[model samples]
Target: MSIENTLSEIRDINLNYLMLAQQMIREDKPSAIFRLGISKDIANLIDSLSNSQLTKLANAQMMLARFRFDDCSILNMLTSYNKDSALTNAHAVMLMANQPVEAIA
Candidate 1:
């Protein structure tokens, strides 16, 4: 494939990931933070951004998506078991966030 095509594919994938992240932020702040490996401050900042700002940020020619998996030990820990506890926890948090709060009678 041409360089341009490869770049275009990367751009599309990045855009898709950005969109999914934004949706997760809107749906569940804590889960988004955990999954995105971002601090609450950064998550809040992202949550507060306008759609245009998000679009501009996502559309940058080159964007860096940082995660906390740089350490081999951390990766090893998560992969030690058949199931990843971190992912399970994140999914739980998201589900809780989506649950409707009930008022006591």
Candidate 2:
């Protein structure tokens, strides 16, 4: 199957879940509250996302939480990992900037 088809299906399913979550939120359904953009049968992808993808997701989540949630919350699988990866990236950059670059022949 093509990537497009796979994504198209995932998108449809994700939308269904999003709607379900919204309805759940309004109906005071705890399960629905956590359903938005989240898959029920979550995949085990602890370090699957590339470094760039990980950083991007974390940044997106951080920005989303600033106005949406009271604080930066890590509720889902990708949440905590993204945030941690972003922090590590930041630290690595800082450490690199602080060090002197040696000239290579």
Candidate 3:
């Protein structure tokens, strides 16, 4: 189900998922992240995603729980990339990701 649905029913669960992921990542017990999958029961509810995005959400949830990266800039970065990849062409790359030969400036 959508996060909205889960949030509507189990407000604390998803919030706790977000928070606990951040906390565990901070504590460095990275392996503990997978436990967040208990909520995976709702995976079928979210829609409009390809097989890959479902995987990314699943993976992101896992990483978010595992890394406990509540303060993670990486989440923003991942969000950006995910958003972009969904909207744009596959050849897009960040400045740093470009090869020396690919540089135009």
Candidate 1, number of clashes:
0
User: Can you write out model 2's per-residue Cα lDDT over 1-105, one digit (the tens) per residue?
Assistant: 996666566555544433444455556434432423232222113124444543444432112221122223322322445647867656544543344422212
Candidate 2 TM-score, C-alpha based: 0.30
- Show where candidate 1 strays beyond 4 Å: 73-105
Q: What is the C-alpha local distance difference test score of each model? A: 0.64, 0.39, 0.38
Assess the local accuracy of residue 15 in candidate 3 as a C-alpha lDDT between 0 and 100.
48
Worst 10 residues of 2 by lDDT: 61-70
Candidate 3's C-alpha runs over 4 A off are 1-7, 33-105
Model 2 ranges with Cα > 4 A deviation: 29-31, 34-105
The model with the greatest lDDT is 1
- lDDT, candidate 2, equals 0.39
- TM-score of each model, paired residue for residue: 0.56, 0.30, 0.24
The window of 10 residues in a row where model 1 has the poorest summed lDDT is 96-105
- Number of the top-ranking candidate, with TM-score as the measure: 1
Better of 1 and 3 by TM-score: 1
Residue range 1-105, candidate 3, lDDT tens digits: 997665454444444454544454445433332333322222223223455544444443322223323444434554564655643333322321332321111
Total clashing pairs in model 3: 7
Residue pair clashes in candidate 2: none
- Candidate 1 per-residue lDDT, tens place, 22-91, comes to 7888899887876676667777777787767766666656643643445555555555664668785565
**TM-score-based ranking:** 1, 2, 3
**Candidate 2, residue 74: lDDT:** 24
